[model samples]
Target: MKEVKAFAPATVANVACGFDILGFAVDSPGDEIEMKLVDKPGIVIKDITGDEGRLSRDPRDNTATVSVYQFLERIGAEKAGIEVVLHKKMPFGSGLGSSSASTVAGAFAVNALFDNPLTTEELLPFAMEGERVACGAAHADNVAPALYGGFVLVRSYDPLDVVRLNVPEELCCAVVHPHIEVSTKDARNILRGEIPLVDAVRQWGNVGGLIAGLEQENYDLIGRSLQDVIVEPIRSMLIPGFDEVKRAAIYAGSMGTAISGSGPSVFSLCRGMDKAERIAKAKVEAFKSIGIESDMFVSKVNKVGPKIIY
Candidate 1:
């Protein structure tokens, strides 16, 4: 194929207990990219939408085009020219893995154009390179799930090991994105570099339980395992109405509530659509009560990651 258009779903990274390790994909509010072959060498950003001119037009600075450039270089196809157009359907800095969606869409579209030269795992590093440019960290919690879909675990980063985890069908996600921007850099900077051993042990236990719960399709265990003793304590303080929103979600029958990625956007996992909708409503109302406008998304886990649209 000479041209391909693809879509990558939005992802929730750091899923409470599994900080920098766990994430899952949601069905809506993602990014789309179209990659077309050209005669000139190198890639160019043809267009960008829904970003209100905040995103860079230069291919080197943009996450999606940067990923495409890296993919081309890795395949020894830098001499081949490509044009990429990005559509940012999700809000930026909303803890919704916006950059990851674009990066995955770009890399996946480029790979599809070349008749699939790399496996999904092989395409990860190229996508992570884009993430590093966008957020200053080569973390896979967001990108892995956006690329492979479902739930993912970043077992190790040194060698870049990632595993796709099982997700229960009844488990639904409710996410609320407040009308506020929180820089990922600022969020990372505010975190304490050290933690008590007791808290670390609790976090480890929760992470292990989460993994087992997912594998066994145990909804109650999953809810019980959704505990964050480290990051959320520090990060949620930066987000307005976070505490109120969490409490409201729980009262509305959510399994558990936590900051989605870093801050500003809070997510809850519910047992089904009915409870998910209730949690979304409660969270949004809580934010509104705190004088913040927000958008809520209720969805089951997206099983397919990035895919060709045309």
Candidate 2:
């Protein structure tokens, strides 16, 4: 039996303007999974580690475990059973795309084990499937970038049109994962069903402008367009120091700052590593004052999505 290993990166979604359609990867943190096909006809999961006993091993409950099983079933495994192991290296509900990374690793591992019967592009739907089980909704904004890397402009879902933009440089960004959990379903429930037409128009304008800014590397324009009057204000109330942390990041010279996902985690884009570190520091201080412990990840924009570690 051939052993297949896969790794996937953590992601930050809701980059101010794109909301459900945008995300980027961060370096050093991710999830890994290994899989091998056996002669048995069923799928079995074993050897889970790294997560604080948070990830479920049941195929129906575990995002990574379900990914392998779904992919094998779709491709007709031909009497080959699956043995899977998950290394959930990222924290749950940290807005770091832990579940998405886990899903991506599992899907790619199974595909590679079967001698890569699917192309990378062909693999997205399977990854999407994995996320549906994980987050209730199949929002691929986080998963796509974690799986494929780089900034993505998800234009449509029916035909799945997304443009992978060239990253201008190894940009510095900071993630402050406050020691808190916001379930995906709760986050969704907090969102209002209706928005003013004027606000909708402005939101689309910002989304379009942000795309152009990224494409041209116009830092000023990008920062200006990173305004979210739609979702951030409503969700910010849930996080203890959201307002102060954002203000501190901007005052500390961050180009932009926003909630990472359905977050207690927040991210700041900065000029360099030093600025990123300072932003992380400011964020920690802001959270600590509110009685929340936080972990800071000083990372750059990760261009390489995922790679096998062994």
Candidate 3:
């Protein structure tokens, strides 16, 4: 095949206690890319849509094209001509893993166009490179889940060890993106360079509990584990109405709620879709009360990550 189209789902990163290490995919608000092989010997980003011209088109600069370019280079196909068209259907800087979704789509599409030369797992590093370009850090929490689906745990970044975790069948997610922007860089920077040993101990226990809770399908444990002692206390200050939204979601039956990745978007996990929907509405109303507009999404955990669109 000379052409291929692919899609990758949006993701909620950090997952409360598992900051920079855990994430899960959602069903909607994803990104897509159409790629075609050509006789010309380089990468070309023919067009980008849904970003209001905010994203870069240069193959070396854009996350999507940069991922594809690096993939081609690794497979000794750098001389091969490829054209890409990225469609960003999600909100950028809303903590929904927008850049990761686009990068995964481009890498997944280009690999498919070449007849599946690389497995999904093998394409991860290339996608992470795109993240490095987008955020100055090649963190895998978002990209891993967006590429592999379901819940993911980044056990080690140096060795690039990643594990896909078990998600309860009834697990559902509610996300609300308030009309505001939070720079991931700024969020990370705001974190104190050092923390008390007591806080670190509490954070570690929560992370371990979260992983075990997911593996055991224990909803109560999951809810208890969704507390962030270090990051949220700091990063959440950047988002308006953060505490009110969290309280509203909890009152509406959310198992737990926290900043999705960096800020602006808050996410909650519930036992069922009904509760997820109610949580979404509650958060939206909470933000509205503060004179802030927001968008909401409710979905079960996406088990399938990127897929062929055409």
Candidate 4:
């Protein structure tokens, strides 16, 4: 059996206003997986790393392993018996698409080892099953960008058509991962079922503008459009120092700033690393100023998703 290696980057969902429908990738946050096809029937998970023993090898509890194996069973390839190992490059429950990145990498490694039995798009649902278990919501915004890369727009969730936009090379993102944990469930709980018509209109406008900004490479336009009247206001409350961090990012010349993936983690957009570094520092300081400790990732937009590295 041939050995295969696959990698996928973490994603930031809710990118401003397109909640559950929009996401973008960043460099630095990601996962890797290695797999080998075996002669035995059924898949067997072999190993894991970087998870600090928090992840499981059991199919039910293991996000990456379970998703890939179950998908194989669905396609009647369970007899192939794959041994897979996943490297968790990011923290679980970090709102950094940690599980999604692992799922994509593991799935791709297995699919590729077996000569790719499923189409790239077909692999989405299988991968999403992991998300379903992780977040209790099988949302595609994060996974789509983690798998496809660049700026992704989930046109429809039922069938999951993602439109990828060209991200300008100069675009930089500052991500602040708070030390505190906010489960996907708790974060979702804070959102209102129905928003006012005026708020909805404002959100839609921002969504349109974010999409346009990506296509046009307009930082100013993107910043203006990233505003949210509905989701952020509600979700922001869950994160301590949220308002301070956002304000600091903008003051530091960020084009836009918002919560990253049902977050306590907030991200900012800028045109250069220098600006991104400034933004990152400001966010960290904001968190500290409020007595909230956090870790920060200063990165640029990822143009590509899962791919072999080394």
**Per-residue lDDT tens digits of candidate 1, residues 1-310?**
9999999999999999998999999988899998899999878898998999999999999889888888888989888988888888999888999999988998999999999999998999999999998988888999999999999999999887899899898989999999999988899999998999999999999999999999999888999999999999899888987888899999999888999998678999988998899899999999999899999999998989888999
Candidate 3 residue lDDT tens string, 173-246: 99999999998888888889999999999999999999999999999999999999989999889999899999
Candidates arranged by lDDT, highest first: 3, 1, 4, 2
Q: Is candidate 1 or candidate 4 better by lDDT?
A: 1
- What is the lDDT for 190 in model 2? 90
Candidate 4 lDDT by residue in tens digits, 90-133 = 87667788888987787777777767778877888878888887
Task: Tell me the lDDT of candidate 1.
Answer: 0.91
Model 2 lDDT per residue over 82-183, tens place: 788888778887888888998889887877777778877777887888898887778889888987888886778988887787666746788899998887
Estimate the overall C-alpha local distance difference test score of candidate 4.
Answer: 0.83
Off by over 4 Å in 2: none
Worst 10 residues of 3 by lDDT: 69-78
Candidate achieving the largest lDDT: 3
In candidate 3 the C-alpha lDDT for residue 97 amounts to 95
Q: Comparing candidate 1 with candidate 3, which one achieves the higher TM-score?
A: 3
Question: How does each model score on TM-score?
Answer: 0.98, 0.94, 0.98, 0.94
1 or 4, greater by TM-score:
1
